[model samples]
Target: MLPTTRSLRLGFYTLAIILGAVLAAGLAMRHAERQALVEDAARANQQLALYANSLHTLIDRYRALPAVLALDPQLRAALNGTVSTEQQDALNRKLEKINGAARSSTLELLDRTGLAVAASNWRLPSSYVGHNYGFRPYFSQTRTQGTGRFYAVGVTSGIPGYFLSSAVTSDSGEFLGAMVVKLEFPELEREWQGSDTLLVSDARGVIFIANQPGWRYRLLQPLSDSDHADLKATRQYDKQPLTPLEYQSLRRFDDNSELARVVGPDGTADYLWESLPLTAEGWTLHLLRQPQVAFEDTRNAALAAAGLWLALVFLLLFLNQRWRLAKMRQRSREELEQLVQERTRDLRTAQDGLVQSAKLAALGQMSAALAHEINQPLTAQRMQLATLRLLLDHGRVDDAYKALKPVDDMLTRMAALTGHLKTFARKSPSGLRERLDLAAVVDQSLQLLDARLRDEQVSTVLHLTRPAWVRGDAIRLEQVLINLLRNALDAMQDKPCKRLQIRLEADEQLWRLTVTDNGGGIAAEHLPNVFDPFFTTKPVGDGLGLGLAVSFAIVHESGGRLSADNHASGAVFTVTLPIDLEAPVSC
Candidate 1:
């Protein structure tokens, strides 16, 4: 059926709105996906750097070992002449002791012709004493270039190791033999076992070292005829079979990273691949992390964008309807009066919505600030858990039980904090009013941070009157003291001398408490805004600057005054509250 012009126009508008909302949702989802990938790349790059450092440090530790042994006079004299069987035994003992002292995998001395004369593993059936390594690349390279390095499987021991070799020359500059130190990475590989896959591949894309068993000796690319022949001649990987790893790049983030789909031993899966080139070793460290963008995050972004699109469309429709109604105002006085009444109701509804939205926004901000305050305790809890795990692993049940005590305390503190924060957010009276001991509050606050004080070696002095009375919430007061103490500790970082002093005394009807730190006092300009929300002198990502602001609010609600000042040594923060005459001297 043929539609009227008005009906057709309305149908077309509805179609456009639907399409626009879908378009907005798609765009938002794509943006979220890209953001997630970018974050993955950043984290993968950091992990890549750490893996590279570990590899480089392990290699460098043994780089000079072979060279040092080459300079040994006793080792050189033994290799110069045809030694008796007794002298050969002595050389083996000497090499074994040196290997034990250096904690190296094995040490072997070769003659000018590359025949093993003395070896640390002389007692083993697979001893390298009679092996001729003259065919090996390291031997040839050392004979010609004075030093050499190679990673290869030991033909005798059937174990893979990195070999560092240095030429042993006579006093007259004649090359005699090579001194070699072998390094194995069983410990390093064990250390890397976790969620992510770590791989170290050579220049030819042949992976030799991997944290996962199935990934070792995997081929990233097809080896050329020359490379294949070289591998066979050098016996670099010995009997280890090289399996090809099929991977396709789904997206490229940069030269060093990409999103890749891999058909590995674990079957098909997508991963964010990050590579770090080790120029010194001519190897590349690869970290494969699975894409971890939560579905909820993408869904939320799409929903928000679509909602915005619908809102804009409705707003235009509303304006159009208003304009049409305005034209009718000239025609009917009665209709205009009805329109005025309807507009008033609409305005009232909008005003109420605006107020509710403002409240929600304020609540969200306050919640974020509370989260900032609790972050330290949460972080400490995580660290304590890690320590507990280690202690338990070492059979230190007593130490592990002791460690659990602080975790329990932190949990109790967090539970109380969450309840108080909800109350603090609702615009309730500053804080609870009750008779409490200020000294007790201070002691509890310091107890929470006792580990930090001992670890940072900060000297703390307490000068307080016992059972100093105060009228405030004990937990809230503890929060304020903790914030000040943390700020002081942060300021004192890297300083030559770190000292903190806390003083509590009676002043008229008010109890006065001051916190002093030799942390190079706060800047004059920043002191004015210390209690202001979101004002931070710290570098971005280091702090949220909500601690002091939240602390100030908590204090103010408790009918207390909190102020900051600068002193010769550092910063001084004072809290003044009305004394509660009811708090007991003990218990």
Candidate 2:
């Protein structure tokens, strides 16, 4: 039963081909992973650049404020002599006005001895007035370097802010004092929307700013005794506990970036840690991201390499066995092209159907708002008619006539509301944008819900800027506004104290509208999915949970953004739309 020479040769060839394919696949997978890492590093570097720019822009904005204030004649004159109580009051008022205008955190005028003579926050409990910052390094650096910058936690205010200082001198060139401006970074942290961990570590390797919670004040490296002494002297991160971030470098891509296994507050996890030196502030911006690879790419790479190897091995066999193999290959290619074309057409049709169906579903889901808008005007007309009857019965013909006019107005409003609702029920063209007043949309939504608000006894606060024009479908925008208003009302329905605030203002070149409610806020876990279709926290029978989803789509369709967040009291939904330049400016 021993195999012949030819059979044995074929068996050996088969084993060698299998081994070669396996090696090729393995090598391809490794290459895929390395390529993925390279891409991730590129993205991380770009993100690092953006973050560094943000930090630099923030510092540069306030860096000149202290310098400009130092040149003030009043500040120079005050620093030259002892500041009396009245002069201190005048300086405080001036600083307050300037701080408000500049939108800086807090400004303080310090004497030559570094005692705060006047501060913008003089009225607050943690005011900086009378607090001497003589021990801080920024004060000394200003005296020596003429200008200085330091980031620290304010000992008096218990708030963390970047301190920018400039020297004040007299006509004789004598060092008079330092003008200091404090800049807090809470807003900046909130604005960093990256999913990766962003940490800003100072020269001492202590992280002072982080986008992620519980990451701040952690040390990138162990602080030396001198560093600890300096921290204590400056009270840089006062009252904040500093902890070591236990980590091990797994791989180094370059000098500034690496892959690491870190035991952080969240948990033990691996991250691609990238660092950028912020030379201006003596801080290092670090971005920690988990390495991510697409399974599809790896699998395709392995398949492609193995297929190429196998095809070469089988090429001569196919040519020797079947001279018609080339014809079959050409036929297969044609079939594949036809199949792809068919699939593309089918997919396009399906997508079109889905979009149309979603639009219909969106309108159908707004039955409650439609009912309210129509019924509100009807109810108002009924009450006005009753008043008219009473006045006519009491021989007050003028009052009866006046009341009838309101009833007529209500009927006209009701007709318009129903007309718009009917029009919105039909599918409109894709490019149905119209230049309309965003403020008017807000007013219309509020009018529709006014009766509901009164019924629920919810106090309202409105801060609207008039003539806020934007390009969008008026009815669709109204629908979005009404959905936000309705959600706010539902949130506060069971609250003991119900308060709803609606604000519409200009932000940059966009019209920003916010709807806020006091209803104990949304649960943290549910916040992310609030606008997801069919995502609802209400009782099963109460809703199908499509309002916010529809509103989100409508806003996006109008080239706008819709977002939701939890505030101290409850949830706030913001709708941001680009301002329409073709429309008249706000009055």
Candidate 3:
């Protein structure tokens, strides 16, 4: 018996459904996790905003100190160049006292003539003291805005620091000079240190300082080596465990806070980090929380849940397969019992019905072929009858004899056609292989569609190069071609520019055949699924959707491949068959 297409299709769809269900379940779980993560991120962003405001205020206070020093009367008189050496020393000593309290890196005062008149900790050369400080942005801002604050490197200190300066004026309210102070970061690192949090203050683009211990801050970026070394040394003072061997994850967010997650070597405790931004540069104030206290139970639960889900899936599959097999066996027994009780006539009737169903499926094309096939014989019979009648009317016996020969030939041709139809309609026993010319099979297929093609004003271009042979059933190949041509015709039914082209070519290895139509092209998304059974773009009731799929199966069974692609103008389907050179061409 030929394999039932319906059963095979049912099995395939069942497998697909099972796989799709498993994939959908996994995707749903992943989506839930993603939604939870998004919620956490929103909360983190809210906390970051509060931190930014606090840091901006602290920087403002540092700028206020420089403005107070520039307004001192003692400093103004000395800057005016009217003071004694003892008076100048006293002014310098007073300025040094102010700088020491701030723990600043450098301090200086400059007069209206751009002359530095006072210094702290570091001294300037006598000739260089009166040179221009007006050219620097810090001093220029102090002159323009009367008070300015920014981070800049020292001209003399040669170290990166914050420069806070402001304009100075006399009691008459006339501008006299400016006072500037530089606060070096190494000093700040000592005072602003935290226990658990690694802190870094990046001024403008440079990281002037960092406070952390050892290799804990080794892999971080946007910080210099000196800053990292300082941070590592500070962390060591706290007696915290900081090791490079740990698999640590440090995340630096846009808010400048760093989250450090460290997985220790022994796996005894993982780290969970929370950071609060600094009140000074919006930099981080981190707190590393030991995760063993919080997430150990959650991790164990997750592992257990994952294990249970996998076990459940396998159990379900096993139970489902067992149930399906039992059901299949039950159905098979019922079918076998029915088969035993079925009469011979019933079986024969069923066989005939199946054959008739196949014929009706191709009825439209078959009707066109039958009309063309019978028309020639009927025409010959009519002409002979007319001649016989005329010969009898004229009483010409010899003429009637010649007409009898033609009449016999027409009847014989009609008999041969009926015989061919019987063979075409019969199903060959399974596993029977025959060597046949694929080109002749194609010709027979075209003959079935010839009348319809002509009626639709569709023309076919045939390029039968040579005898391309294949080891396959001719009837099966013919059926595939008939389906293809009919589909082509239906596709072009509404096209104003309808054309069909079939080209056959062969080499030593393969037989290549292409059927092309100048109709509306298949949509791009539909191309891949065009061969799938029951997938049709056609309107309802227009197609059963099994033709191309059946055609695909037929080609595959013959050790061939069939593919459809969208052409620029329409759709083209090509078939490649492995050819047998020794096979004889069959009519």
lDDT of 1 by residue, 1-587 (tens): 34688899889989999999999999988997898778768756865665666676677556656766787787899788996799889989988977776678999999999999999999999999979999888999999999888999999999999998999999998999999999999999998887789999999999988998789889999999999899999999898898899999999999999999998888999999999877666788899988877565566667667766766665565555456555444434554467776765555655565565555555555544554555445546545654564445335788688767676664455345434321322222223587778998888788779999999999999999887877777766786898999999999997988999999999999889999999999898888889864568998667655678777877887888999999998999999988877736595
Candidate 3's displacement at residue 465, Å, is 99
Write the candidate numbers in order of decreasing TM-score.
Answer: 1, 2, 3
Q: Weakest 10 consecutive residues, lDDT, candidate 1? A: 421-430
Local error of candidate 3 at residue 433 (angstroms): 98
Q: List the residue pairs that clash in candidate 2.
A: none
TM-score comparison, 2 vs 3, better candidate: 2
lDDT of 2: 0.80
Worst 10 contiguous positions by lDDT, candidate 2: 421-430
Give each model a TM-score.
Answer: 0.57, 0.54, 0.34
Number of clashes in every candidate structure?
Answer: 1, 0, 5
After superposition, the stretches of candidate 2 with alpha carbons farther than 4 Å from their true spots are 2-12, 316-587
Tens digits of per-residue lDDT for model 3 on 1-587? 24678788878967775665555545544543343333333333333333333333334334445654664567777766665678767867876766665545557788776567667763544322444656565666777778655554444444555667878877777777788876655644454343322333332122234444342322333546775575444221233322233335554433533344564333433333445534333344333333221132233333334434444444455555556555655655566677866555555655565555455445534444554565456545545654464345335688678768676665465345434532453344323468887888887787667788778888677888667778887877777888888888888999976889998898569888889998887888998888774578888657646678778877888889999987888888898988786744489
Q: What is the C-alpha lDDT of each candidate?
A: 0.80, 0.80, 0.59
Using TM-score as the measure, the top candidate is 1
The C-alpha RMSD of each candidate to the native structure, in angstroms, is 22.5, 24.7, 38.3
